[model samples]
Target: MFSFRNFNIADWFSLYRIMAVPLLVAFIWFGERQLFTWFLLISYSTDAIDGYLARKLKITSARGSQLDSIGDQITLVMGLIGLWFFENEFVLANYQLILLAFLPYVLQMIIAFRKYGKATAFHTYLAKSSAVLQGVFILWLLFFGPVYWLFYFMVIVGVLETIEEITLIFMYKEWVEDVKGIYWALKDKRRLKKKSVKNPTS
Candidate 1:
């Protein structure tokens, strides 16, 4: 649910990212490299801002997490689109590796929706690190150009993060929020509770 009339300041930031997608897309379509990079940077920064504000103000909720994840996915796709447009030759050169890292990501989304009726929001540390590297790699490519070292590192982290997310999906029956990663999941009472529910005699 949107909490229509009750959105807090942190929620507003998340909403901004969602609402700004059209603008980001427009920049890409118009071939406005600098404009796209600047606005995308702002959009990416809001991801961090919203999360910090939610925690600091104690305003976190399931709705906020969902909104935040949707915003993140959209903004990231927009960034990748921008990368493809601005750095065509570079992307063309490494398209194989890109697809290799990207396929697992798509699979993870499919599995999450099928299993829990929604995408995940585990927000694991590995996931966060991947996001940071992705943002840096894309923005750096747009602002400067492709840095091979960073590109390889981003791909490795991206694949690892995708694998971690997919693993977590199997670890929890229902959707979860803010699960640090698989290690934290091992100690998660929510997972244990759900398991206990399934095997009552155990």
Candidate 2:
């Protein structure tokens, strides 16, 4: 997955987040909240840049999607760690809410791994929205503090995205990437053809 020979410009951009992880951890270790937040912002920016570049350049591929998803997951985990370290009181105060929002995501991961032997990189529109809200909410908390409305919206969108992902898992039967959402899934010829192939008698 980390093969440099096959990586393109956008893949390298996606890889930036994973490569930044150790530096981010070091920033936290030295108690450099400002530096950590700044670098974290840069990391998040790469997420948008990579995706746009991939589509614009027509360099999208299964490998690229998987790599991007890996980078996103790493960045999110590190962001939450940074939040817990810098905003311990806030995290503790909202621990239950955070856990509630995270539980379904955990379940989705488990389901994906069991079905596909890896994580889903569906990149649905809802997933994109959820990622944006999560990054915004975390950055807001880190830079200033939590806004109740933002946090609530983030949690709601996140849970909905996870539910959609779980639903897609069952719908696909086999692992697929870049599904937009259920509406698009219903019209997905790839999925429909797979079903037809499996039950030809029907």
TM agreement with the true structure for every prediction:
0.95, 0.96
Error of 2 at 73 (Å): 0.9
Model 1 lDDT per residue over 94-191, tens place? 99999998889999999999998888998899988998899999998899888999999999999999999999898887887998988999999856
**Model-by-model lDDT, in order?**
0.89, 0.93
Worst 10 residues of 1 by lDDT: 190-199
lDDT by residue (tens digit), candidate 2, 1-202 = 4689989999999989999999999999999999999999999999999999999999999888998999898989999999989999999999999998888898999999999999999999999999999999999889998999999999999999999999999888788889999999999986757867887985
Model 1 bad stretches (over 4 Å) = none
lDDT value for candidate 1? 0.89
User: Clashes in model 1: which pairs?
Assistant: none
